[model samples]
Target chain A: LAKTTQPISMDSYEGQEVNITCSHNNIATNDYITWYQQFPSQGPRFIIQGYKTKVTNEVASLFIPADRKSSTLSLPRVSLSDTAVYYCLVAHGAGGFKTIFGAGTRLFVKA
Target chain B: DVKVTQSSRYLVKRTGEKVFLECVQDMDHENMFWYRQDPGLGLRLIYFSYDVKMKEKGDIPEGYSVSREKKERFSLILESASTNQTSMYLCASILAGEDSNEQYFGPGTRLTVT
Candidate 1:
């Protein structure tokens, strides 16, 4: 399992774009980067995932560098409701028991 | 939509009492996992089951055990609950052989042992 390191917290204003970066120096070839969002007292929700390059979805975008050592999760036009803890996980494509979630980045969306 | 349901949203138990946490998923995912989340420890895996009657210990499995009697249901058992076992327990399931490692999580159960 590739361990992920992220900032403890980040602050952004409403309508501003937020980017959270994760560092995984020991990422493997088969490892994929996945991001999840969790609100207070709720389970983490899947946001976006990518192996390499850029992958965009309606919710967020995942950008992976060529080295695969780091990835960025970009949230566009953040709102107050988007304030949550964001987790970046690096695991194999078929990750089952090998999945690990570290202390996530707490994003505070200010009005 | 993938839906995972836990037996309880909150539970209170006394020390030395037996505790059971049940999780059920409607997607029939083959892999079910039990994890405990704390203030600073994030999420630590206790046990995971890949198939019926098959189980594997994760990072933290000392005070926990799991049973998967059916494909959709997995149960976590704490033989004798202690005060330290008080934490939020989360259950998740993922389909096997899927290209994406998307996991569906249930509303966590906040267990308080006094």
Candidate 2:
């Protein structure tokens, strides 16, 4: 399992773009970068995932550098409902992969 | 949509009491996971099962055990509950092989051990 580091908290305003970066210096080659968002008491929901470069979905975008050392999650036009903790994890596919989620970046969207 | 449901949303137990946390997924996924979340510490894996009757210990498995008798259900057992074991318990499931990009999580059960 690869370890990830992210900001403890972030402040953002409604309609602003929010980007949270996660560092995984020891990331593995076969690993993929995945992001999840968790509301107050709800379980984390899958946001976006990417192996390299950029991957975009209806909710967010994931950007990974060529070195695979770090990645960023970009949320466009944030709203108060988007206030939650975001987690980034590096994991492989299949066969009981034990994923370790670090202390996620808490995003507080203000009106 | 893949649905993961836990047995309870909240629970209270006394010390030395036996506790059981149940998780069920409707997606026919081959992998299920149990994790405990606490303040400061992020989600820590307790155990996981890739197939029926097969189990694997995760990062924090001490004082905890798991049982997977069927493919859709996974159970986490606490033989003797302790106060320190009080925390939010979560259940997750994912598909097998490369398509397992993300793990779907349950609503979680906040277990209080007194």
Candidate 3:
């Protein structure tokens, strides 16, 4: 498993775009970068995933450079409800594999 | 939306008592996992099951055991619950073959052992 490092916390305002970056210096070739969003007392929810380049979804966008060593999760037009902890994980497959979550970036969206 | 239901949302138990946390999935997902979340430890895998009768020990499986008797159910058992064992437990399920698909998680169970 590749080790991941991300910001401990971030602050953003409503209607502003927020980007959280994760660095996996030793990322594996077979690993896929996945981002999850979690609110207080609730389980983490899947946001977006990408191997390289850009992958966009309704909730977020994932940007992975060619090196695959780092990735960024972009949330468009943030709101107060978007205030939550975001986790960046590197997982291989869906065969009951284990995923390691970092301390996660705590995004506090302000009004 | 895939539904992974945990048996309890909150539980309070005493030390030395047996603890059982149940999880069931309605999507027929072949993989089920147990994880514990703490303040700074993030999410640590306790155990995972690939099939009905097969299980694999994860990074932190020493103080816990798991059982999967049916395809849709997985149970985490603490033989003698301890104070350190108190944490938020989360259950997750994913399809068997999707390599890049995301996992569906159930509302976590918060266990407090005193």
Return the top candidate by lDDT.
Answer: 1
Worst 10 residues of 3 chain B by lDDT: B94-103
lDDT (Cα, tens digit) per residue for candidate 1, span B1-114: 679999999999999999999999999799999999999777888999999999999999999999999999999999999999999999999999887888899999999999
Q: Distance from true position, residue A59, model 3, in Å? A: 1.0
Off by over 4 Å in 1: none
- Fraction of reference contacts reproduced per prediction? 0.67, 0.72, 0.62
Report the lDDT tens digits of candidate 3 across residue range A23-109: 999888788899999999999998888888999988998999999999999999999999999999888755528777888899999
Clashing pairs in 3: none
Clashing pairs in 2: none
| Chain B structural similarity as TM-score, candidate 2 | 0.97
TM per candidate = 0.98, 0.98, 0.97
DockQ ranking of the models: 1, 2, 3
| Residue A60 of model 1, lDDT score | 94
Query: Candidate 3, residues B1-114: lDDT per residue as tens digits?
Result: 679999999999999999999999999989899999999767888998989999999889988999999999999999999999999999998887786658889999999999
Give, for candidate 1 chain A, the lowest lDDT window spanning 10 residues. Answer: A91-100
Candidate 1 lDDT tens digits, A1-111: 789999999999999999999999999888888899999898888898899999999999999989999999999999999999999998777754578898999999999
Listed per candidate, the RMSD to the true structure in angstroms reads 0.8, 1.0, 1.0
Query: Candidate 2 at residue B25, lDDT?
Result: 98
Q: What global local distance difference test value does model 1 have?
A: 0.92
lDDT at residue A64 of model 2 (Cα atoms): 93
